[model samples]
Target: MRLPIVAGWPACTVMNCEADQAGYGEDKCVTHLSEGELGGWLSRLGPEAEIHLARTQLAKGTLDQIKGAVTGQDDVPQFGYLSLRRAEIEGGVDLCYSRFSKEVDLYGLKVSKYLDFEGVQVSGGLDANFIEAPQGVDFYRAKIGGSLNLEGSKVGEQVRVARCDIDGSFLLRGCQVSGNVECYEVKVSGPAYLSNMQVVGDISFRNSSFSDGVQFFYTETSGYFNVSDSEFSGFVEFEGLRIAHDLIWERASFRDDVTFDKADLSGLVQGSCLFYKGVNFIRTIFRSAVIIQACARRVDFWGARFEVGGTLLLRYAMVRMTGAILAGPTSLVAFNRNFVDIFGDPMDEFVIPHEDPNVKLLDMGSVNAGNLTLVDIDLTPCRFAGAFNLDQLRLEGEWNFGTPPSGRVGITPFTWAKRKIIEEERQWRALRSHPLVLRSGWGDPPDNPRDVPGVAALMTTYRQLRKGREDAKDEPGANDFYYGEMEMRRHNQSWGKGERWLLQFYWLLSGYGIRASRAFGWLIISMILTILLMMGFGLPQDSPKQEAAGTVPPGGGKVTFEIDKEDPRNPIGDRFTSKRFERALNVTLNSVVFHSSDQDLTTTGTYIEMASRFSEPVLLGLGILAIRGRLKRGS
Candidate 1:
C-alpha cells in the first residue's frame, strides 16, 4: 500500500501520534520550538502545527500528551532530514527502515522485525542484533562502515542484500535462516558465514566474495546447494552438512577440495574439484556412482561413494582416495583395487590428494562392470586372476604389433615367471634331500662291481644324521645311496613329493644289467671248469697256470684254486685251476692240498681251496650269465 504524499510530516519522538502529520501546510512547525520539542519535528512542521509524534521514536524521555492524539494507526511515523542520523535502538523489535530518505545514516539500531533500509546509506553503524525476523534486513544499497553487526539474532525469513556493497561479510553462522539467503551479485570484501544452522530453503551466494574463511558447519538442508561462484580468500569448509538433495559446486574456486568429507549428501553430485586442494570423502556413503568431474582441481575421496552406478572419469585431472577406503564409482574407475580400496595410492598419476575431495567414488569390490580390457597390456609386472571373459573385453594397442591381442598365445614364459620363485623354493629349499644312505647298488655284479670311492661320503653324512652306529639308512635303501651303506643303512628320509620319481628308475635297474652282468658271468663259468679239471685229471695241485687274473672297471677277471692228492678215492679232489683274462684284460686262479695240508683243509679242502681261488672268475662268469639271462627274458 502506497503512503500519502501530503506527507510533509515532521520526525517521530516521545510526544503525540499525529505530531508528524501536523505539518499539513505550515512554516510555523519549524519555527515554534518549545522546551520539550525535538529539532526534527520543528524542521518539517510549521509554527501553526499543534500535533507531536515523538513518543515512538525509540526515545528514552517521558512522553507528553499531544494536542490531537489517536491510537491504532497502521502508517509509519515520518523522519525529517537526517533525524535518524545518530539514533540508537540498542534492544527493540519490529523497527521499520522504509520511511527514511535514501543515503541517510542509520547506525547502531538493535532491531527485531523488518529493518528495511533498502537503497539508503547507513553512514553510521547499523546494529540488527537479537532480532525476531531473518528477512528483517533488506539493505538493497545500504553502505555500512562500523561493522554492521548482526552477531546473534533468530532469523525467520530471507536476508537479501542483492547488488549491495558489503565492505564486510554478511556473517550469519549460528543464525538460523528458515528461508533462502538470496544475495546474488553482492560485493562483499570479507568472507561469508551461513553455517552451523538449518536453512530449510536453498541458500545462494552466487557471485559473492569472501576474503576469509567461508564455512558452513553442521548445517541441515532439504533442497538444492548453497554455494557457487563464491570467492573465498581463506579455506571454505562445509564439513558436516546434512544435505537432503544434490550439492553442486561447478566451477567453484577454493584452495581446498570443496571439502565434504563427513557431509551426508543424498542426491546426484555432478561437479569437479579439478583444482581443489582436496575433497575428503573418507567415510561418506552415496546412493549412486554417478559423479561428474569436469576439469576438477583435485579430489580426495578417501571413503566416499555413489550408491547408484555411473562413470567417474578423472579425464585430464588428478585425484586421490587418500586413506582407509570403502567407496565405489557411480560409473567406473579403472584405477584398480588398491587405488580405491586401499586409498591414497602415492604412485598413481591421475589421482593425488589436492583439490577434489572424492565424494562419489564407490567400492564395488572387484570390477563388476562387464570386464576390464587387458589386450596389449603390460602383463609383465601385473598378475591378473579371476573369473573373466576376455572374448569381449578389448585392450588398446596397434594391430600391426607382433601378436594380436586375441591370437593364439603361448604362456610358457608367463606361467614360469609367475610361479618360478615358488617352484624353485620347492625344488631347492622345500625339497632338500638330506641323504641317509648315499649308496646302494642293488643288481650290481660282484666282478664288474659297484663304486667304492663314494662310501666315505655316504658314511659321514649317515653317521651324523642317524647318530646311530648300527647302519646308514637310505630312504629307499638302495638306488640312490652308497652300496656298502645300502646294505647297512636304515632310515626313511624320503618324505617329499619330488622323491616319487625314483620308483620308475628303481624297477628298470632291478634286473640283470647288460655289460657288467655278462662280464661277471663269463668269469664264473671258467672257474667251474678249472675246478673240475683238477678233480678229474689231477691237474697238478697248485697248477702253475691259474694265479694270474683279476679285476676290472673296464673288463677283466681273476680266479684261484686248491688241490689234494692222497687218498685213492680222492681222485685229485680239493684241487682247483681257473682263468678269465686276456693280457691285463685276462683273469686266472689255482690251488692245491697234499699230506702236509693244514687245519684249513681236508680231502674236501683241496676242492674248497680250489673253489675259493677260482671264486673271482666264478663270480665274473656268473655276472655274464646274469646279463644273458636278462637278454633271454627280453627276447
Candidate 2:
C-alpha cells in the first residue's frame, strides 16, 4: 500500500511513519521499525531503488529481540553510505550481498551475535574500529573497493574473510579474535596490518594474495596459523609473533623480504615456501618440529632456537644465503633429494651424481649448539661454499653420516651397470668438449678456480670434525673423517701442479697414510721381482779364477774346492749337493731379508740387496703405523 503524500510531508510507503525528521529526503525515513517491518520496507525498495541514508539514521533501539537485522534473502539492497557508529546489535547482522555505494562506518559498534558481510560489495572503505562481535564476524567473498579498517575490534568467535577482495589497505591491528580467524583466498591491494592481534583459535590466510606489504607483528594465535599457498608481493613482517599451535606456510610465495624475528612458536612450524628476496627468522623459537621443505634466496636464522620434542626437518630445501645459525640442542634431519646440484656446478654440461643421492647441503658454519644429533645425513656430497665455522660446535652424540634409515643403499649389479653406462656417456661427452665451450647444463661442475668453494668448505668441515673426534678420543671416527678430508684434498682441482702431484704420489705410495698394507704389498712384489732377476741373470757369474787365489777378491767369487773326507771345513756338508737354482734362490732370499749367506754376493746381486735394504724398512714402518692406527681406533 502506497503511503499518502501531503504538502511538504511524506511518510514511508509501507508504514504510516513520518519522513526522516532530519530532512534527509522524502524517500528516506528514520524509524524504530521491527525486524518484520524493516524486512518489508527493504523488500519494497527493490533492486533498482537506492537507499539514501544521508543525514538520516535508521536506528533500531530494541534490536535485542530481533533474530537478525536482515534475515530473508531479497535482491541486494543498494545503500549510499552506511553509518552505524556506536550502534548496538543484539542479534546477528547479515549484510550478505549488500552493495554499499560509499563508505561503511561501523565504528564503536557491539554485536551480540554473528556479524556477517558475505558477498558484500563496498565501493568505499570499510571502517569497523572498536567493533565488538561476541558471536563471530564474517566477510566471506566480500569485495571492498577501499581500505578495510577493523582496528581495535574484539570478536568472540571466528573472524572469517575467506575469498574477500580488498582493493585498499586492510588493517586489523590490536584486534582480538576469540575463535579462529580465516582470511583464506583473500586478495588485498594495499598493505595489510594485523599487528598485536590475539586469536584464540586457528588463523589462516591460505591462498591469499597481498599485493602490498603485510605485517603481523606481536600477533598471538592459540591454535594453528596457516598462510599456505598465499602470495605476498611486498614485504611480509611477522616479527614478535606467538603461536601456541602449529604454524604452517606450505607453498607460500613472497616476492619481497619476509621477517619472523623473535617469534615464539610452541608447536610445529612447517614451511615449504618460496622467497624471492631475503627472509629472516632471527631469535625465533620452535618448541616442536620446524620443517622447511624449500626456499630460495637468503634465509637467515641467526639466533633461532628449537626444542627437543620433535625433529627439525629441512627436506628438499634450497637456501642461498650466508649461513643459518642453530643455537640449541636438537635433532636436525636435513634431507634434500634436490641437493644433488650442490655436488656439481649447475651450469656444467655434465654433472656427476653425488656420492649419495639423499645428500643435503647444510650450512652449519654459524651453528652454535653444544650437542646436535645429525642423523641420516652424508656430508660427502655437501657443498659447503663458505667458511664452515664449527669452532663453537660441541657435537655430543654420534655424528651419523652414511648410517641407518636413510643410509646409502647397496648397489646391485644392475644398478652398477646403469651407473657405469652413465659414467661412460659423461666421459664421452667430456672428451669432445672444447676448453672454451660454454657450460650450458643443469649440473654444476667445478670449471674454474672460483668453483673450488665447495671443496674448501668440505675440507674445513672435515678437518674440524676430525679434530673434534680426536679430542673426544674417538679414533675410529677421526680416522674415518681423516680419509674424508684427504678425499676432498685429492679431488680439489684448484690445487697447484706440485700439490696435485704430491697428493697423487702420496696416495700411490701409502694410500694417503690410511692403507699401509698397500705399501707392504708393493714391497713384497719388488722382492719377488728382484729374486726373478737374480735367478735369470745368475748373479754376474762369479769369476772362477778368483777362487784359486789365496786372498778374497773384492767381487767375491764362488770357491769350488775338491770335496775330501779329510778336509775338516768341508766335512759331511759337501755330501749334500745343491742345484744352481737353489744357490741363486738362497742368495736372493739373503739379500731381501738383509742376512749374510755362505754364498758370495756378486756385483749385480749387491745392487739388488742394497735396493731391498732401502725399501724393506720403509715398508715395515708403514705396516707398523697402519697396525698402530687400527689398534688405536679399536681401543
Candidate 3:
C-alpha cells in the first residue's frame, strides 16, 4: 500500500520507510536524514551561494516520536529558517557549532533527552519559550542577535549557558530548572527576567554582565546561588527571593539600586562588591553570616533578622542610611571602619579617609537584640562631627571601641615626642585648607557647645552597656562602662553651670566615686604638702601668760623649766622649739588624721585643718568602697 518513489528526487534511504517521501537531493529523506546529510544540505545553502539555493524552502521537518532521527550536525551549518514547533523528539537535539541566519523557533517543543546548542550563533532570536526537556539544556558559547526567550520552560536537568552573548533580553521567567543553572561569563545586552523562577539546584552566574536590569523576584533556589564577579548596569532586584543555601555576590558591581526586601537568605557573602546606588535589605532574614564590603550611597537593613552561629561583618563599608536594625539575636555584629553620614547632604563626599569633613552619624535607635559582640568600631572620629545614637539598643558582650591597649613597653620619651610631632603635622596638613576645619572654632565659644545631644546619646549607650554587664555579673566590666557613663555626664553641659563644676570636682577628688586608689594617693600628697607648709611656717605658740612658769626648784643645771603648757589635752603643747621636723610631723598628723597632736597651729594651720577635715572623710569613704569592690579598681 506504500506510495511509489518520485523519479527526479532520490528515494528515502531510511530503513522501513513506508511513505514515498522525497529525499533532500541526497540519499536520506528529509524526515529521516542523518546528521552528516543535514550538514551537507546546510553547506549548499551558504551566504555566498546562489540566492535561490540559500532560500531553498525545505519541507517541515516533522520527525515526531522518531526513534533514531539525528538532530546534530558536525560542522557549523548555515540555516535559513528552522521551525521545530510542536515537535516531539525522542533523541536529544545537538546543534553544536551551527549558525542560523534567520529565526529558529522551538516553541512548544518537547525533547526527551538533553538539548545541546553549544557554540551556535543565531542571527535572529531564539524562541524556546514553553519548551519541555526532561533532560538538560546547554547553550554554552552561543551568540544570539535577539532575545533568548525561555519563559515558562521546564528543564529536568541542568541548564548551562556559560560564555553566551545575548544581544536582547534573556527571559526565563516562571521557568523551573530541577538541576543547576550556570551562566558564567555570559553577557546580556538587555534585561534578564528571572522573576518567579524556581531552581532546585545551584544557580551560578559568575563573571556575567547585564547591561539592563535583572530581577530574581519571588524566585526560589534550594541550592547555593552565586553571582560573583558580575556587573549589573541597571537595578538588580531580589525582592521576595528565598535561597536555602549560600548566597554569594563577591566582587560584583551594581551601578544602580539593588534590593533584597523581604528575602530569606542563607549564608550571604557580598564582600568586595561595589554598589553605586542604594541597597535595600528591609525585612530580610539571614540564617548565616552576612559579610558585606562596599561604599554605597545608602544601605537600609530595617527590620532584618540575623540568626545565630554567624557574624554580621560590614568591614570598611560607608553607608549613608541610618543604622541598620538587627532584630533577632546575633552572635557578633561588627562594623569595622564603617563610615556613616546620617545628617550631612546626600551629595557630600562620604568615602573613608575623607568622611571626617561631614557629620558621620550612626543612629542605632531601633535595635532590640542582646548578647551581641560589637568589635573593632571607633565612634570617636565620627563623634567629633556628629552623634552615635544608641538609644534603646541593648548589647551584652565584649565592647571593643577599636582603641589599642595603652601600656606598651620599650617606648622612650624621645620616640613618643617624635611620633606626636609626626601625627600633628599629618593632621595639620590634612585639615589646614579645609573650610569646615577653618570654621570649627570661629563662632563657637571657648566652652563646648551646651545644647548638643551627642553627649546624652553617648551616656545612654554607656548606661545600657553598663546595665547589661551588671546583669551578666561582670562587675569589673560593668564598672568600666559605668565610668564611661559618668564621664559623659561630667561633660554634659545641660547640667546647671554650677552642677557641671561640681561634677568635675567630684572626678578630680575621687574619679566619680570609682577611683579609690586615686583618692588614697591624693590623701598621701595632701599630707605631704601640709607637712611642708607647717615646717616652713611654725605652728602658733600660746601667749606667754598662758604657758606654765619656769620652775627652777631642784637640780638646777641650766634651769630646765617647762616652757610649754602641761594641760591634759596638750601634753606637747604649742611651744617655740628648734625641732622643726617633729613640729611639722605633729601638726600634719593633727590635720590629716584628725588626732589631738601636741601642737596648736596658726591661722594658716587652722585653714589647712578645716580643708583636710572635709577631704579626709571623702577619701576614706572612697577607699572603703574600693576595698568592698563597689567601685572600679584603678579606674
Candidate 4:
C-alpha cells in the first residue's frame, strides 16, 4: 500500500510507481532510478528538496547511497524532508550524525534489522509511529527540535534513547518493547507521554529531566522502572501504571505535583525523592513493602493499600496523612527502629538518621490493623474515632498524645487539669454547640463542627488505648487514657441518672481516683473541720470533783463514809480556752486513725467521735488509692 503524500507533492513519472517524485526536476522515484541516474539526481538535489520513498522496497546498499547523498561535507549536515512511510528495508538503517532540517516520516515502515539514529538532529520532527523493527531502535545522543512521535511501535530488542534531547513533546504510547527501554541522561523540553506501553524488560530513565509534564498511565513493565537522579519540573502522572518489579526513584526531584494514583506494583517502591509540592498515591496498591525517604511539602496516601506481606515505611519523611487507614498488619513508623513486615519477618535494615522529624500523624481514625506499631510518631493531632482492635495495637517510643487545654477562664478560679487525652475527645469538648462543651476558656471550637466525635465513640477509643497501654505494662500511660475514658463517661447524657451523679462526684472529689493531691487535700481539710466542731460543742465545761462526808454512829464503834459526784455538763463559759483546745486536738487526731482517746465527754462529744471515725478513714483511704493509681504497674 502506498502512503499518503502531502499537498503540493507530485507522484513519480515512472509507470506503475505510486511513490512521490524526488524534487528538483527528478521525475522518477528513488526505487525506479538507475545507479548512474540516481547519482546524477542526487548531485542535483538541494538542501530544501523533499524526497518521498513511500511504498518503495529499498534494496541492499540503496539506503547507504541515500544517506550519503543527503549528508553534507560541513560540520553539521542538514537534509530536507524525507519520507519512508510503508517502505520495506532489506537491511539495517544507520542515519547517525546527520541532521534532518524537516520532518522525517517513517510511519508503518518495516525494518529487517536495527534502525539507528545516534547523534542525529531533527529540526522539524521525527515521526516513526507504527514502525516495526525486529532488531531494535536507537536514538542515543540525538536531538529533536520538534516532537518525536513513536506511538504504537513494536521493537524486538531494546529501545535506547539515552543522552538524547527532545525540544517538543515525546510520545511512545501503545508501544511494545520486547527488551529494556533505556532513557538515561535524556531531557525532554515538552511533555512525555508513555501511556499504554508494555515492556518485557526494565525501563530506566536515570539522570533524566522533563521540563514539562509527564504521564505513564496504564503502562506495564515486566521488570523494574528506575528513574533515579531524575528531575521533573512540571506535573507528573503515573496513574494506573503497573510494574511487575520494583519502582525506584532514588534522589529524584519533582518541582511540581505528582501522582501515582491507582498504580499497582508487585515489588517495592523505595525512593528518597524530593517533591516541592504534593505527591498523591491515592488507591495505589503495593504487594511488597514501600520504603520512602522523601522530603515533600505534602505526600498523600489516601485509600492506598498494602498486601499481607507488605509494609508501609516512611523513614525521615515529613508527611501528613490525615484520615488515613492503617488496616491489616501495617506498621506506620516515624523514627528509626528495627521493625518487621506483616509476616513477622525482619525487614531490610534502614539507616535513617536519628533526628527528630517534625512529622505529624494527623488522623488515623480509620485504623483497624491487628498489629499496627507506631514508633515515635507525633499523634497529638490524630483522631481514632473509627478505629477497631486498637487494644491489640503496639505503640513504642515516645508517641505523643493530646492534652487538656490549660489556663483559667474569666471569673473562674481554677485551671484545667493537665492530663493526656485523645484528639477526638478534645475536639468534642471544643465544640461550641455541644451540651458539655468546655465553654470556660478551654480552646477554640473544632474546625469542622460536623467532625466532632460523639462521647460514646471517644469512650470506646479511650478504653481501647488504655487496654493497649496496660498490656504493654505501661501503667502511667494507661492511667492517662483511663482518665480520658472516665471524662467521656461522665459527659455522656445517655448514662443513668444515678451513675452520672456518681461519676460527677468521683471526678470532683479525686479526679476519678487518679489525683492524689486532690484526695489528700480533702483529707487534711476534713481533719481540721472535725477538730473545730469538737472544741465548739462536743467538750464538757469542766471535770466533775468528788467529795466525802463522815458520820458517828452509836457509841463511836465505826465510822461510815459516803461519796458523791456531779454528771459532766456542756461548756457553760470560757469554753474557748487553751485547755479546751488541747482536749479537742487529742480527740480529732485519734478519730482520724480510727483510734479512741479515753477522755471525759458529754453526749454530744460521744456522737462527734462516732461521725469522725466513719468519715476520716474513708478520705484517707481515697488519698492512698489515688497514690496507688499513679504508681501502679501492670501485672
Candidate 5:
C-alpha cells in the first residue's frame, strides 16, 4: 500500500509536448476548461503541474509504471510520489520512468520496463522488468525499503544499487544481464534470490548483508565477483552455476551451507568459502580446479561429506587442520567415470582454474572443522560429470576409497583408483603415525607397480589432484573421538604388505641394516647392563653365568675363550702373589656368596653338556666347509 502521486491535474497552455507528458489539471483544462480558469497559476509550468488519467483500469493487467521521451533537457517531466500497488502488469509499463526527476514508487505490482526507473525512486521499489537496460538501471543514492523484485526481468544495463536499504527479496530469478551490477552497501533483510539469473558483466556484493539467503542457483555468469565481507545468515547458493570469470569471495561469511553443487567455475576463485560447521554435498564437480591464483591458501574442504566429480587441483593450497584430508583418486572416481576422457592426453578446456591475484599455491591449507560435523562422502562416477571440486569441502567423515569392482570393465582407472584409495586408507594409520622406515636418507626407490609407482606414490598423486576444497558453513565443533572417526578411514589403517616390502628392500640395500642394527644395538645394550649390574654388586663381571641374562646365544655356551693375553680373561690368576689379588679373590668369593645371578659355570653340568652338543653340530658343519675348500683346491 503505497501513496500514489496526485494526478489528472489540468495542464498549462504553452506546453512543449502533448497529452501524456502534461494533461488536464483537475481544476481546469479539459472539456470545458482553460489554463486561465485558475488565475493563480505559476508563471513557469513544470511536469507535475499538469497530469492525465487513464479512462479505465487495464483489462488484462495493471500497468506498474511508464516511460516517455522528454522534449528537451530543460523540459524534463516531474512525477512526484507515484505509487502502483498490486497492479496487474502484462504487456508493459509505458511511462514509468520517462524523465529523470520523477519521484517514482512501486508497491505490489508487476511491470515490463522497455521503459525505465532512471532517476525515479528517491528510495522505493523501482520495478523495471523486460527492459533491456543497455545503459543499466541506476538507483544512485536512492533509499529504498522493502524488496526489489525483478523476477524474470531482463537487464541490459548494469544494475547499480549503491547505498540502498531494502527489506525484502531482490528477486532476479531467470533474469539476464549483459552488464555489471554494483550493489555496494545495499542492505537486504530477506533472501536476495538471483537464482537462474545470467550476468555477462562483473558482479559484486561488497559490504552487503543478506539477512536470510543469497541465492544464485542455476545461474550463468562470465563476470568476476567481489563479495568480500558479505554476510549470509542463511544458506547462500551458487549451486549449478556456470561461471566463465573469476569469483572473489574473500572474507565473506556463511552462517549456513554454501553450495556449489555442479557448478562449473571456469576461472579463479579467491578467498575462503568457509564451509559452515555442518554443510553436506552429495554430487559436486570440479574440473581443473584452481584456487587463489597467487595467494595459494588451500581452501578448506575437510568438511566435505559429499560425493563430487571433476579434476581436483590444489597445487598451491594450504590444507587446513591436522585432521584435514587430501582426497585421493578414490575421491574423484565420479569425475574419472563421468567427465574425464581417457586413452590419450587430457583435455585443456575442461579444466577450471582459480587464479585470484592474491592467491598462491601456499594458500591451499588444512581445513579447520574442529567444531563441526564431519563429512566423508562416498564417491561415484555419475557425480563428477557435474561441476564439483573436492577442493571445496572439509570432510569430517572417514575418507574412503570406495566400492570394489564388479567386473573387468569396472577395472578402469576409476576402479584402480578405488583400489589405491582403499589400500592407502588401510595403511594410513601406520604411515601417519609410527612410520616403518623413519630415517631420512638417499636410498634406492623400490620397484614400482606395473601401472604406476607403489601405492603411496599413487595415493599422493591422487591427493595432488584435489586442489580446490572449500567450506561454506562453519558453526560448531566436533568431539575428538567422533571427529577422528569422521576422518577418512585411510588415516586409521596399518601398513600393508606393499609398505612392508618397500621398507624391507630399503633396509637390505642401504646396508645400514637398520633393523638388524637396532636389534644388535639393543642386544649389546642389554649385555652392558648385565655387566654393569654384576660389577655394581661386586660380583664376577665377565661371567655369562650372571643369571644367564640373554637366551643361550644361538650357539649354546661353548663360547671359546678368545681373549687376547694382554686383555686377560680374568683377574683370578691360578697363583696370585699380591695381597690385592687375594683381597679381590676374597671379595669375589663373598660377592658370589651373596649374588644369585653369578651362577657357578663349573657346577652347571647341564650347560656344559648342552655346549658339548652344540659344538658337535658346529664341528660337523665346519668339517664339511673345510672338506669343500680342500675339494675346490684339488679341482
Candidate 6:
C-alpha cells in the first residue's frame, strides 16, 4: 500500500512508502513492519527516543505495543517527545500515568473517542491546538510543567482538567467545547487566557488557584460562569465576557485587581467573594440581580447599566460603589448580613470579621436615582453630586447620614450640635476658607477635590434628600436636611442681600424654626427687655385726671357733658414706683399676645406699647413655629 508522506523525518524503506520511520533507523513504518520486525523495533524503543506518529492511522492494539516499549520502571509510559500531528487514532488515545520529558504535539490530531491523560506529567508544554476530539479530553490530576494550550480546538464532550497543576500559561483561547469544561481544584502558575472561548455547557474553575491571573475577554458561555472558592493572585480581566446564565463567585478571593469592563450578564452576578484589591465593572450590563456579599476594598461600577426588577444586594460587603448607574427599578441594599439574613438559613456561612464588612463609601455622583431604593446603608461618606432624579430616590429603613461633631470641640465655645447632615455639606463647611466654619470646628476638608460640592449643588442635594425623607414620612430626618438646605442657600447669597439677612435672622431666632429652645430664649429676652424699657421710660410721672363740663344754653332738656383729658407728658422722675411698675408690667404682658391694655400711659409709653405689640408678638409666634417644626408629622 502507498503510505502518506510525513515531512521532517526519514521515510519507510518499503517500496513507494513515504510514512515516517516508527523507530530510529528502522527500515519500515509501523504499518509496513511484520510481526517479527515490529517486535524487534519495539524492543529497541527507549525513553530518550522521539516518537513521531504524524499523518498515520494507529490500529486498536498498536498503542499497546508502543506503550510497552516506552514503559519505564513502575510501568509508567515515558517519552522524550511525542508528536501525533494530523494522525488518526482508531481506538482513541489513553496515556494514563504517562510521563513526557518534552512537548506533546497533538496539532491537527484526530481522536475518534476520548483522549485520556489521567495522572500524566509533562515537563514541556502540550500544543493540542486545533485538535479534533469527538468524545472528550481528560487531563485529570495531570501535572504540566509548561503551558496547556488548547486554542481553536473543538471538543465534542467534556474537557476535564480538574486537579491539574500547570507551570506555564493555560490557554484555551478561541476553543469551542460542546460539553462541560471542568477545571476544579486546578492550579496555574502562569497566566490563563480563556478569551474568545465558547462553551455550550458550564465552564468552571471552582476551587482553582491562579498565581498569574486569568482573562476571559469576549468569551461567551451558555451556562453559569463560576469561579467560586477560587483564588486569583494577579490581575484578572473579563472584559466583553457574555454569560447567558448567572456568574457565581462565592467565597472566591482575589489578591489583585479585577475588571469586568463591558461584560454582559443575562442572569445574576451573585458572589460572596473577597477581594483584597479593587474591581471594576465599567460599562457592564446586568439583566438580573447582582448580589455581591464580598469584602472588597473598592468596587467600581462606573457607567454600568442594569435591567428592571433587578436587585443589588451587597450584604456584609465592605465595598465602595463609584459612578454606578441604577437606570431601572433596582432595589439596592448594603446592610449588614445579620440585618438581611434574619431567617437564619443553615447553609449560610457565618463570616469572621477582620473588620466590620459594611459599605463605607458610596459615590452616587453619576447615578440615576429615579427608581432606586437605598435601605439601611450608611451615607456618611456618600457623594450625591450630578445625580439624576434624586427627588424620586427612595430611602427605606434607618438610613444614616453624616453626623455633626460630637461633644465640645477643644476649649472653644463653638460646638457642632448633633444633626444628621449630608456629606457634601460637611465637606463644604470644612473648607479652610470659611473662618466661621473653622471656628465651629468642622474638622478637615475633603482630600479629594471632587468631594467638595458647590453651594448650589449642596443646596440641590439637601433639597432632594429632604424631599425624599418627607416622602418617606420621616419628618424628623427631613428637618435636618431642610436646615442644611437653608444653610446652603444662606451661604450662597451675599451678606448685603435681604434674603441672606432674612435667613440669618431666621437662623439666629429659631434655627430655621427647628430649635424651640433658641426661639423661646429669644422670646424671653424680648419680654425682659420690654419690661425694663416700660419701667424706665414707658410709664408716666403721674396719672392723668378727667374733668366734666356741661353746656346749658344750647340744650335745656338734656345736659351735654364733655370729658376732657390732658395729654400725658414723658416721665420726669421716679418711673420705678410700685404703681408705675404695675402699669408697665400689665401693658407689656398684653402686648405679648397682640392685646392692648386699658391703662393710662405717657406719650413715650404709648409708642413703646405699639412697638411691643408688633415685636413681642412676633417673637412669641417664632417660638411657637419652632415648637411646631420640632413636633410636626407627615400628613
Top-lDDT candidate index: 6
Off by over 4 Å in 6: 1-23, 27-37, 47-49, 54-60, 85-88, 101-103, 315-327, 338-354, 404-418, 430-453, 546-569, 572-583
Q: Report the number of the highest-TM-score candidate.
A: 4
lDDT of 6 at 224: 91
Score candidate 1 by TM-score against the native: 0.41
**lDDT value, candidate 3, whole model:** 0.60
- TM-score quality measure for candidate 5: 0.42
- In order, what is each prediction's RMSD in angstroms? 23.5, 12.2, 12.4, 5.2, 18.9, 4.9
Clashes of 5: 114
Q: How much is the lDDT of residue 540 in candidate 4?
A: 84
Candidate 2: lDDT of 40?
62
User: Which parts of model 4 have CA positions greater than 4 angstroms off?
Assistant: 1-6, 13-18, 46-49, 309-328, 336-356, 435-437, 440-444, 494-496, 543-568, 572-579, 598-608
Candidate rank order under TM-score: 4, 6, 3, 2, 5, 1
Compose the digit string of candidate 4's lDDT tens values, residues 227-345.
97898999999999999999988777788999989999888876556666678877788777666556555567767776643444554444544334554566666635433434555
Better of 3 and 4 by TM-score: 4
lDDT by residue (1-635, candidate 1, tens digit) is: 01112234455332433233224343233223354443444344421223322112443321111211211143333232232222333233322332332122232333344556565444333444444453456666656542344544566567666766666555566656677656666666666566776677776666666666667777676666745555555677777877777776544556544666577777766444334354555556565444544444445555454455445544323344323222332332332322221233222224343432222322112222233222222221111111122122233331011111222224322111111111111112211132312111111222312312132333343232222211322222221212222222222224354433343222223221223433443445544554454344432333232234433545545544445334323324433333212111111243211122232223453565555455554455445544443344211
Rank by lDDT, highest first: 6, 4, 2, 3, 5, 1
List the candidates' TM-scores in order: 0.41, 0.59, 0.60, 0.87, 0.42, 0.86
lDDT of 4 at 123: 84
lDDT, model 3, position 94: 75
lDDT of each: 0.40, 0.61, 0.60, 0.78, 0.41, 0.79
